[model samples]
Target: MLFKESFSMAFTALLANKMRSLLTMLGIIIGVGAVIAMVSVGMGVKSDVVNSISSLGSNMLIVSPGSTNRGGVRGAAGSRTNLKYDDAKAIKEKIKNIDFVSPSVSRSYQIVYGNQNWNSSVMGVTPEYMSIRSLEVSTGSFVSESDNNKRNRVAVIGSTVATNLFGTTNPVGQNIRVNNQPFKVIGVLESKGQSSMGQDQDDVVIVPLTTAMERLMAMDYVSSVNIQVSDANKMDQVQEDIEVLLRQRHKIIGGKEDDFNVRNMTSLMETMSQTTTMLTILLGSIAGISLVVGGIGIMNIMMVSVTERTREIGIRKALGATFQNIMMQFLIESVVIGVIGGIIGIGMGCGLSMLVGKFGNFTTVITPLPVLVSFSFSVGIGLFFGIYPARKAAKLDPIEALRYE
Candidate 1:
């Protein structure tokens, strides 16, 4: 028979059982929908993580005192007080591919701005902290080199702090207490929204490291230092150099391990991406199982269809129809069922993906690749499931088929 005749016969057979075809399509529909929805959700999370980390800066590297341990039994090489102001200055002068450096001595204090009092974090950092952290000063000037040199008790407040304290009044050139020590207001930072850790980036205050260490915090040790590299390609070399220099500076001999650590934002991004990719693959595979089950349902229905048409087959063969025609006709019927179901599933998947994008509070974009992939896979499933039943019908004897009730 001609290919057109085969296809028409197959389509006609499927049309004879519209209800069964529709029910078989339902499984494929749900499977495809789940695949798109789950993958879109994973992609949304990954995009959020990448943008949030990138906001910290492109070539930003964090150097902390505890990082020297390299994830030993101590865990995470957490920051220690071994870092000092002189170490920060030395890193500034010594490291190659160096851009800007900020040594931070962080403290939490109960801040009183008029009648509104709140406990807030305060950081002792140099003016360079602004450039290293990509922080911007909105209302006033950032604390300058002269401010640090003179050990001036000047501070910069976040916008949240500004709203809480002075209302609409100009906070600059005013006095606020840091640990109840009077400090002149030098600058106010623009709102940074939040950090990757979900902490409010704008809920803190800033002051010259000198003033913080000497006056209010009253500590001799630095908690950690943030380092910005001039070249992204040179990060490894620079990290190695910083480790060697700090190790030597801290008076630790080689082979015994260093007392400090260096970190870059790239590693954090890699970790997040790896996790998301795995989740996407896992969800896709689980959704794929439903497609297999749907294919099995198609096969079961096709077998029953063959059995029901036994007398029809006997009459066709008695009329001199070849076994090849019989095989082709039933095979076409199975493919018809699969192809129609695939189209419906693709539509359902795309529609569901859009619904998720709209109401799920995440950006779930439907690309053409996944749609095509899913549809083609469904059609393949149809062919695979149709094979056994089509062969069984073709192998039936004309005598036995004619005798069927």
Candidate 2:
């Protein structure tokens, strides 16, 4: 028989049992839909994280105190107050690639303005902090070098703090008490929603580092230093330079670890991206199990089909149909079932992903790669499972088959 005739025979047979064919495809439909939805959600989360971190600044690096060993007990990173203001000053003056350096120290304090009182984080920083953090003042000005030098008691409040304390009133030029000590509000920062860690960025107040260390916390060490490099490509080199410089300043020799840690945003980006990619592959693999089950369903139904058409097979063989032609007919039927399932599965998967994004507050992106992969895999499953049934049908004895009831 010609290939076209075999295809026609297969099409007619499937059309006669439409219900069974659809039932066999159910597993494939569900598998494809689940895989697409889950992978899309993972990618969306990764994109959100990257965007949030990028919004903070460009080519940023963070330096914080490293762990301290107290007798054999080691503390967590930043547990030791080893990072100081002078370290930030030295990096700013000596580093050629660095654009700005902002030394910072933070503590929670009760802020009182008029009759309103709110407990919020108070940050001590320099004027360069505003640019390094991508923060802008809506009114008045940020802390200047003179403010840090004079140890002036001035505050810059975030939008959330401004709303909570001053309501609709212009907060700049107003006096707010920090830890019962009065400080004039010099600026109000623009609204920043939240960090990737889900912490509110607009729920704090800023002051000069000198004021925070000497007046508010009574501490001499800075909590961290935020650095912005001039070029993103040179961040790793700059980070190494900063590490060597800090290690020398701290007098660490040989293989001993330094007292401070340097973190570049590029490394963080790569780590986060890798994590999400792993999650996507994991989800897709789990969903693939259903495709195998669907293939088994096709095989089971094809076996039954061969049994039911035993007399037909006998008649065709007795009429001079070759073994190859009989095998081709059955194989065509199975592959048709798979191809139809794949097309429908693609449609269902895209629709399901969109629905999830709309109602589940998830981000979903349906790219062509997943669709192509799933469709090709489904067709392969059909061929793999169909071989046994097709061979069995072609091997039937014509004499016994014709005598069947």
Candidate 3:
């Protein structure tokens, strides 16, 4: 019955000063709301990066030419013209658990069809490159083995390239010029949108590797080799095997540096996941500072309330109210403010997330974990900050409190 009376008195006190109570909770509301929104944004970015990496291909690995040491001075990575089409062929023939290997080279060129021209990247790849890169031909066919073998001047254009160069016209079977060299369009690729790095995936053209090396660029070496593993579980093993095979092929022995670099998509994805997770934690921590400030606000207000209610404390003590009763009342008041503020903040956070998702360029993914965590933290802050003020109010001397004007 005493506890009930104390709680009732606490509720009445808050209701009597509605504006002050609302102002007291304002800090907590902002803190919790910021935490939820920021965490959601971080999670969305992490999801985008993972999905972007996955879209490249399943169990994928890329091998590129390493740096070269010429005249005792090292050049940048991929400056060595060591990666060849034969290296890719050897991997497919000798390596086990390999699904497909596509050797590719790329260069930028101005594509022209009639009067419309657009500068776009042109890649030379085998037919297997389509499956490896998760590319789909929307119309007509992709580069065939015959095309690569015969070094035919046929091209497959991306959606962005198609839109810029041909507009609405069907580009398949139409003759176009790449860097003033005439080529026939064999297919148009489906739209892939933007990558995680904001690069337009559909702003390129593809031709046969042989044609790119011998005819267009006149370069015999490939820039990179993309390999797909048949089994996801064997990705690491396959990467190691490829490294070993390349070392033997390049005649590098006795701790000599490799002439080629191998990269595993799975490892890249894991590193990105860790980076985004840390970013999320960092954002949440920055927002949590507001909660601490709100707790301090609660403590300050409770201290003022204690000073204002000194005479009331005296009267309650004279009426046989215990120290525990006074402490309970102030604690309840702070807790009530925190609870209400936390609820409002959750609604505000969710609303903000929805609005951002609807209007913003990036996505926002609101999860229940952040909501629960923020709410619990707010309540904890309230309870913790209320202790000192509640203790001071409980310990007030009845005679001194009563004498104070």
Question: Clashes in model 1: which pairs?
Answer: 67-261, 68-260, 68-261
Candidate order, lDDT descending: 3, 2, 1
**Evaluation by lDDT, superior candidate among 2 and 3:** 3
Q: Which digits, one per residue and each the tens of the lDDT, describe model 3 over residues 305-380?
A: 9999899889888888788888888999899889988999899888987788788877788999999999999999
For candidate 2, lDDT tens digit of each residue in 1-405?
A: 999999999999998998998898787777766667777777777777887778768799999897434257677534578888889989998888999999999888999999999989999999888888888888889999999999999999999999999999999999999999999998998888877577788999999999999998899899899999999889989999999889888899998877787888878888988988898888888888898999999899999999999999999999998889999999999888888888888888888889988998677878888888988888888888989999999999988889866
Stretches off by above 4 angstroms in model 2 are 1-12, 68-79, 112-117, 136-154, 162-177, 181-192, 316-328, 351-363, 395-401
TM-score of 3: 0.91
Question: What lDDT does model 2 reach?
Answer: 0.87
TM-score, model 1 to reference: 0.81
Q: What is the lDDT of residue 169 in candidate 1?
A: 89
TM-scores for every candidate against the unseen true structure: 0.81, 0.83, 0.91
Q: Count the backbone clashes (under 3 Å) in each candidate.
A: 3, 0, 0
**What ranking of all candidate models by TM-score puts the best one first?**
3, 2, 1
Highest lDDT: give the candidate number.
3
Write out the backbone clash pairs for model 3.
none
